[model samples]
Target: MKRFFLQILLCLAALMVLGGCQSKSEIVKLPRPVGTLAVAGFTNPMFNWELLAGYLPHEGQPVNKRVIRELDQKLVQTLGKHGVTAYARPAITRQCQEIEVFENMGSKREAAFSYWISVGECMAADYLLVPQVLFWQPHRGMKKPNYNVQPASVVIDLYLIDVNNKRIVRRIHFDETQQPLSENMLEAGKFFERGGKWVSAMELAEEALDNGLMELGL
Candidate 1:
């Protein structure tokens, strides 16, 4: 009986060792960075759409500032929920934009990792969260006199780079399309009402972030 118990313990120990040596893709919880993490290099190529009337900023308002502020705040909140110290520094983002090293790279992923390392060195950050807003567009479908159903589609790519290691620790890609509830006419009307809030896209993005973090076991 003692021999059998010893064999069982050995097998369990072997399994634990194998689990620790598993590939990154198979790993559940990722190792956290050394210290405080900062968000940098957040870019949204959708600035061209600011030409439209609705998206245009009013006097004294910076273009695209509102969206960036909301997104940045959400990221900070998400990291806080995970018990990670995080902050969004606009200066870091501006500096990243000015750097030419990441542009026209042979490997975009490698270039991004290098960029994060550089930023981390400048700020002494343990980790850098790089978020890219790939797509943010709205599609409308319906004829005149019929209620218009518009869907807001957004795609975001988030990369957590370990500054000390100069490598990407995790990458999360999220894509979603959110539309107002057409079945509820009153609610649908409220969505399109002038100056009324339209929260589908924001809600979906938050949900995606939550899901991504949970999947990463972070």
Candidate 2:
């Protein structure tokens, strides 16, 4: 009967939908390196405010130095749990100054690369781990869920450099901006995982840190 066929089609569609919902993307693991790693800590991007007027508000706020220090320590501790020896060097003002000199002469990327190499030599670390905070927008209201409030957003990049080889061992980039389930259906699982509550910038960054490290197999 036509009605029976319609019901069967609907059931098949429902099953297909459920299957899609349960599917998850696989995370590719990189080779784990041997030897100790020194965490270089987080750094803020240097942007020209005049040229990036519209983007200033989103990324202009200075991340607290204390927060940076805490993240560095957290990374070191996380590595320790994985049986990886690591140390944190949160104070990098002098290193930044040296990098600036290179920046004045050439591209910022090149300057950073050169600085990192020098840092590895100075620390005598077999490897160096650098974490950079690209953008951070904290929740406006109380660190709890408020339908009327904006959710936190953050972007972080982690790099593991093989000091002796002068090459990158692994890199992970995390960029997350919390949005309502209605806005991004793909993140429905994450929404429910967070209990449908908005989180703070710190919370988001911490999640990113953990996920990044895990993806690195650390």
Candidate 3:
């Protein structure tokens, strides 16, 4: 009888573990936005980007440009794939550049929201998708004889705003952080040494968008 009880307890514990795993893997669905969606691509906001460059290698210019182009393409494709009826509007894109050049939000969150709302209104879009590159930096990894390791880090922020309501419907953020490894010497070094291949900002942006879309259940 005692042995039988032990076996039953073990089975119960296994079931509990499986149940916990399933709960953790449950998919989270994002509320689908209503009406037309316009995507606005980014241009390097001089202040933020310039400051970020101080920490990364190669001045970070190449990555910045690539990120802008890739993000625009990826966002439209991703949103369309998920049945969001999204398009990148040149008018709004141009306006975003103008705002970055002339206006400085300087940590005022509402000011940024108001700008997006106005853009959506001007474009006649019901929702505006705003994506920003928070950071892109390539660290150095052994490169003297033959490049053995290369790694990079990137951060992206995505926002979906309702033009009619002047409200943000979805806000998503992503980070490309290096993970630690124990077995492989190269990967382990890449994680700690802050060194790796110079990854383009565009590539990082594309990854961030892809991740965000997946998280959105798209």
Candidate 4:
């Protein structure tokens, strides 16, 4: 019996080691110098009507405009910490409008690509950073509620486009929904990081942004 128990412990240890070596964020391609990037701001999944026309069944709740603005500011601040100079939102809007690209955004892939390049040129930026919010579900407060409460959930995608080449150089996609420790042993670290309590949607997104950028070497 003792030998059998020892073998079980060894198996668990092996599993833990394997999980620790796994990458948390999905990254495509390699990172490049972001010299003066123009942040195109975060896009709402709901507004991408053209792309979601046939996929409405898979869509999640739309995030509030205020929440998006907060996340955008956090992204800019995070970029600054990584030594990347980013253009503010107002500048992006002004430049896009000046180039007549604001009105045609998300209409077509080709048009969007041209618009990104044009906006980058107008802002004198080398790259354009675009973020899209896919899902957002805020967690209830610490105070116990009489009703059932759902944990925070968020999904975000980041794209780093080469303005001159008009191509995506790097991309990071983060999707996570908090679950009880019993349900997912692989996420034990995250559970401890959150103090074993529910976290807010903004908090989850902030963590995702930080991790995703780090993975991209930004």
lDDT of each: 0.56, 0.65, 0.56, 0.67
Model 1 misplaced regions, further than 4 Å: 1-29, 45-63, 86-110, 138-147, 179-199, 215-218
Give TM per candidate.
0.55, 0.72, 0.59, 0.72
Clashes of 1: 0
- Measured by lDDT, the strongest candidate is 4
Model 2, global lDDT: 0.65
Q: Put down candidate 1 lDDT per residue, 23-47, tens digits, no spaces.
A: 4355355555557666764566444
Number of the candidate with higher lDDT, 2 or 3:
2
Q: Over the full model, what C-alpha lDDT does candidate 3 score relative to the true structure?
A: 0.56
Worst 10 residues of 3 by lDDT: 49-58
RMSD of 3: 10.5
Cα lDDT, model 2, residue 196: 67
Best of the two (2, 4) by lDDT: 4
Stretches of candidate 4 off by over 4 Å are: 1-34, 47-61, 86-99, 102-107, 141-147
Which of the predicted structures, 1 or 4, would earn the higher lDDT when compared with the native? 4
lDDT of 3 at 20: 35
